[model samples]
Target: MKPLKRILRILKTISLYALLLIYLSPFFFVLINSFKSRREIISNPFGLPDVWSLDNFVTAFQKMDFVSAFVNSLVITFFSVIGIAVFSSMTAYIFVRTDWRFNKVMFFVMVAAMLIPFQAIMIPLVQIYGGLNLLNSRWILIYMYLGFGSSFAVFLYHGFIKAIPLELEEAAMIDGCSRIQVFFRIVFPLLKPTTLTLIILNVLWIWNDFLLPSLVLISSSNRTLPLTTFYFHGTYTSDYGLLMAALMLTILPVIIFYAFLQKYIIKGVMEGAVKA
Candidate 1:
């Protein structure tokens, strides 16, 4: 019986590893194939490269102008993230702490706005962007991101805020802190985990977004990293190697960032959800 149980445990472990490999094999394939030359990729699709080369990386950079596009994406994502976190945090605090006649009405309105589809408003948004003379600028996209990011961020913050006892702020106020200082100094620090979650979530969404940026940013140089696939697809029509290399480069930064920060993201999400 002991021998049989030990064998079963080993088999279960093997099966778990097999499932993990099955899920991750696609990424492993891309990472390996991105280094292979065009001919080698076509001739031996799943095998190791005949000779390792950086030619595809060079071509992808030159063809897609990867560096400039990445810079545009980073800048747009940064501002959008900051604006969303600050606006949403302040707004959520107002909703939670204030005693206004319209408090409940405003919260319901935010919930309703979350239900509205972006497609329904795209035309109006485009016209507004055009009117602002922001059709080819990153700022338009940043603002749009703020609008979309707000609904979710507010909900998360609102939930997390409920778990915070009001007496903490009352005690701070008793100690001579002003309303703004009580919030910025005391209540705000307690909400750090939720804010961190919002930052990560908004940054990921704004960074990987392609459709909105495509519509708002028409110029090649102003294009976001994901949108750079426009010319990459058109120009490298027959070269799968170059296409895959570009794809890999675009995904690497996201993967690296998530690898280090994912612990905090998960912790924040769990704390906010469970405590709310």
Candidate 2:
């Protein structure tokens, strides 16, 4: 029995490591190739760089106008995440705390909206906003992100808020705190873990999103990192080393953001699950 258990444990460890390698393989491929020359990358993509150089990164950074694109991404993601977290948490609180039929109906509708694919409404949404001359603006893009992201954010917040004791809010209200005050002071602070989780999730989504930004932000100056990276590919040819470097630059920020806050995501989800 002991030998069988030990064998199973060893097998499980090996399988887990295999899965980890599988997931990380593409990133490793890109990282290694980014340091190689274009010719080297084309000839031996699977091999390590014979002479690792920062030339690709330097050229890619300048060509992509990486600073401008990075600023655009940062502004859009920061505002979008803030709007989603604030509105969704408050909206979820209303739905969870109140017995209003309208709130219940709205919550149901929002959840139903989550099932509808964005691709289904993508064209019409763009056409309408474009006709109104609302496209190409960061604020407009943030508004659209809010609309699209709210349902999932609300759903998560709804479950988490439900787990919170009603008495806490009631006690605050009785102690001279207004409804708004109670929420901001008591409820919102407690929602930090879930909010951080949502922030990280939305940051990754809004940061990497190319299609929506491509459709909306028509100007080169307004483009995000992912959209700027598209310039690396031409009609007949592409710079693989530079492209790989640009890709790495695009993903590096979010990777660092995720690494710092990743523990909270699990903590938030587990707490919400248990509470719900």
- Can you tell me which runs of candidate 1 are displaced by over 4 Å? 268-276
Worst 10 residues of 1 by lDDT: 267-276
Report RMSD for candidate 1.
2.2
For TM-score, the strongest prediction is: 1
Tens-digit lDDT track for model 1 on 130-180? Answer: 897868877777888888888878888888887889998999899999988
Residue-level lDDT for 21 in candidate 2: 100
Which ten contiguous residues of candidate 2 have the minimum total lDDT?
Answer: 229-238
User: What are the models' TM-scores?
Assistant: 0.90, 0.86
What candidate 2 gets wrong by more than 4 Å, as runs, is 1-8, 265-276
